[model samples]
Target: MDDIRLLPATGLEGLIAQLRSRGYRVMGPTLRDDAIVTGEIRSASDLPQGVGDEQDPARYRLRKRDDGAYFGFAAPAQSSKPVFFPAEEVIWRGRRDTAVTPDSAASASTPDNAGNPTTAPASSPHDPGFTVERDQLDAPPIALLGVRSCDLRAVQIHDKVLAGRTYIDAHYVTRREATFVVAVACSDPAATCFCASMGTGPRPAATDPATGEPSYDLLLTEIAPSDPDRHHFVLEIGTEAGRDVAHAIDTAPAEFDDQHEALAVTAHAASQQTRRITAATVRDDLRASAESSRWEDVASRCLSCTNCTLVCPTCFCTTVEDVSDLTGATAERHRVWDSCFSEDFTYIHGGPTRESVKARYRQWITHKLSSWEDQFGMLGCVGCGRCIAWCPAGIDITEEAAALGRMRAGGVLPTGDHVPTGDHVTVTS
Candidate 1:
């Protein structure tokens, strides 16, 4: 059964040490280049202590907190996407080698430039034989520390899309299965955050029933100082592995008051959030908004720089590139993250199908909110607010969805003069 324990601030080091002792490469939030980013953590001191973040549309800044909490921020600049779904990875390697039979090698010999007879090599590029080999993934087991609720849910969404599907990504499956998650409750939800409305969090849940796996091995909830000795963390054991680590760390059974305070912290965060998204009808509304003029208005400001998709934990579009050596003897294939905002993403025989920026934007949002559910049984966005804070143009998905709702309520429709035809517009919902 799951159990709760209280750990003093000093016990944080022991938690990390336990994970390390178990041969897990622990990664956590660290201050890097003015941002709290996820990176390798050797000790508890590497965490961003006393540092918090202020985030709004197109704005993100770090600030010092008086609480002296290690995980007082809402969300980091980057999520755990790069850990499981890396930006770039080699998928396979190919080589064109010269083929020589055993008899040919034994009886036939080629003359060297010095006129000396030399037995033909077994393999050379000139022989017109090609072979491709899949690259073996060699990654250490990982333990994620201080992951927020929205991002943890985002990882679950990726698991459904990438690993739990008819066609599986072996690389993603391998890393995800070998990972241990340490989730921290959000006590500092940013202005851009709307995860509460999405039913994702402010409070964190330990298990995902869909996947039959514990969402986090250990869950942390930081309680503010009620007294000199009262400042401590409420740690919840979600799995057997978490129980093992808990035994190694210095912890006591959580007092009734300690657990109450932990719940209050997440409750306050939920209450502080003013942003909400009514996403129930958004899918159908977006499908009908194909002819909506709001796409043009938003496209005018969108730079299509793809920052939103890059920071998004659930955006899993990818593109592959093939490279060959100068002599064409060796070739390699790499898979890299891609974005739907790119005009070439929907390219057909005659140039790009979505030639206009407006069409590309519509396609991205439509697929993210509408088609994604149909394809994967869940919405693509987890309401992490990364797209809003990182977008240079400050386009807010919630605001855009509200705009569509208002238009639908007013019975407003776009004029037919701008009706798009040919391959210039995206017709797919």
Candidate 2:
């Protein structure tokens, strides 16, 4: 750890004020609609202090913790994907007119048949040509607080897919570059979480495997047991911007004491999760099990509602739509999040290729676990457990991988709902 600092819980106010003073909007975990959600936060009081959550397969509930620690819980229902890659965004907009050309700018004059300059048509006061609204897109610098390690990695994964050299998504690139990330250690992961097995989290990792360098600007670790009287936070500055924020807050250097030791203890406890990807080569195992009966087994219980993909931070599938006004003069092209689970997602000239739930489920899981390595040089899942907790069918990815492995091993499985006995599995994949 470089430049470790001890910040009292009250120091959060100074941190927020410093970020705001620097033209950065502070967003953190807050209680909204009976769930922990990331939104605009004004002060430390806006954070969900003394609040945690209980999460299981297809189940999640808010609960009060014994202590008043601000970051006591596991991941919230929503990930930080929305902040960088929104559910829907207007990439470009244009206005059509008989009086002017589509390529003409708002300031340009249209030629009347004689090539004489004519007054530019007033189309709702704004420009007629395609305009990139930076303010509407919120392209300013943003400070993301309380970001989990798994989600922090997810943002990088999305960058690889969207902002890669092959085909760059300019919007994602700008937002990602402008965004400031602050990671919070997951002291207590949920039952559905498998970040430990995925090698993504439980702790805010020092170096990102994707980038081969520090992943966050700053990292926060909660220490409650260490200072039983008052909750303390260990802040680590990873970048110069992080150091500037610490200086602004008048933070002091932290010593390697009981507080850091206590934080380590809580972090270790979070790694004792039962759910895990047992396969040594999860990617190869998934590829070999393509013909296994596990697909049918999982499809029987799968709803194909796209909940898992929507909540998943690494899922980057999307579709573009062109919507025009009633006059058909003004139009906008929007990019919306899409899921492979939808039968229409595979739609071609004729019809959807993967019509059956078995095929669709198989494709989705295989792509996430197997082919993603070939395409992106990494596994798609970070093991944040958002897919398991958000899935209405309670399909656990760990158990599914285990079940699929067994079916591929012997070409036989527990059929007719005999129930998995002694498998130590709580959720089905």
Candidate 3:
């Protein structure tokens, strides 16, 4: 099979069938509860065809499209994180068992040890013993269809955070390794998208380091119809497995015109996006603007609801909990996704360290934009703008970063008559 091929829009059903025949549980975009979301998709008809989304600060709505194109929506309400790194998972389970032991008198009365028999006290049950077992995974191979570019980058970030050097999450590794990706280049970006500035997407660009191949097994770029009512996709095979699947379907080699139209699709999507941020310099500027008054202004509007962190694909904080049965014979431990916005998240010996909303808000954004680079060697945000559209108060991260930059250039500190002293900030009367 050629590396690049043109697949008619109808060919998508064949693609799904091929994956299922290979023992993959195919998941893709579908309309659920009035939103486009990922779910088990058996065929192209199961996808959210001819549907688009409208997104703005504190707003999201589903709209109709005249072009009957699948993969027409931007980022879904949920990212791929829930599939690999589950929101809640049981790590281990334990069971208690009882055993019997002979009393001292009973031992002395044994045939070999006792001369004359005194009535021996009945044997008693000894201390109960417990056995623990770690949860072992046996999930089926998963083929994720219709992944967007921003989300592809988000998955890469999750790999670094969960399966990196010092610590590795075994469950995440197991699921991630067993999954196959089918990424789609964005042709209809939402108003909230800023991946153009972040360099994460409108197009599929991630490459797997281990295999030196595109991160997706199969990448798709949908070109708008040249003919009034026809649509097709430019499919790029990125792995041997993808090539095998392509062989199962009838595809023609992509021509120069097909490739050109595909490029135009992604380019037009990038140009249509209204949001912007300088991803390269935001880290350094955020590190220096910790003392900026902008934190207070943002906090006043922030409910500390943790919506941003929950929607954020790169956020990895979690908490563990233990459960026991009524008889205390069975026990289980679970790891649940947690948020930095929770006051209890920062609880220390005294109390919650970040008691004020101001301090918590400062920590959340600073860690995401600045200190994340210090820890992970990359900024935490993928610029998907889920945080912006989902926030009830309409607080925008890009806007906050820009405000901080503007304040820094003016040499005006947030507090009155104050100036930064070398590496420290000082206040004056």
Best by lDDT: 1
How would you encode candidate 3's per-residue C-alpha lDDT over 1-429 as one tens digit per residue? 368898888888999988888889888888999888778889888999889898888888999887777877888887877878888999999888753244523444444446666645545445557889989998788899998888888888888889875889988988887678889999888878888888888887758443344688888987664344557889888888888788789778887777778788899999887787788888888888877877767777899998888878888899988999887788899999998889999898999989988788889888988998898877788889899888998788887777777678777676653333222111110
Give the TM-scores of the predictions, in the order they appear: 0.88, 0.86, 0.88
Candidate 1 worst ten-residue window by lDDT: 420-429
- How high is the lDDT of residue 354 in model 1? 86
The C-alpha lDDT values of all candidates are 0.83, 0.78, 0.81
In model 3, what is the error at residue 192, expressed in angstroms? 0.6
Off by over 4 Å in 1: 99-127, 225-228, 415-429
Clashes of 3: 0
Question: Each candidate's root-mean-square deviation in Å?
Answer: 7.8, 7.3, 7.9
Best by TM-score: 1
TM-score of 2: 0.86
Pairs clashing in candidate 1?
A: 98-124
User: How much RMSD separates candidate 1 from the native structure?
Assistant: 7.8
Q: Compute the lDDT for candidate 1.
A: 0.83
**Candidate 3 at residue 260, lDDT?**
79
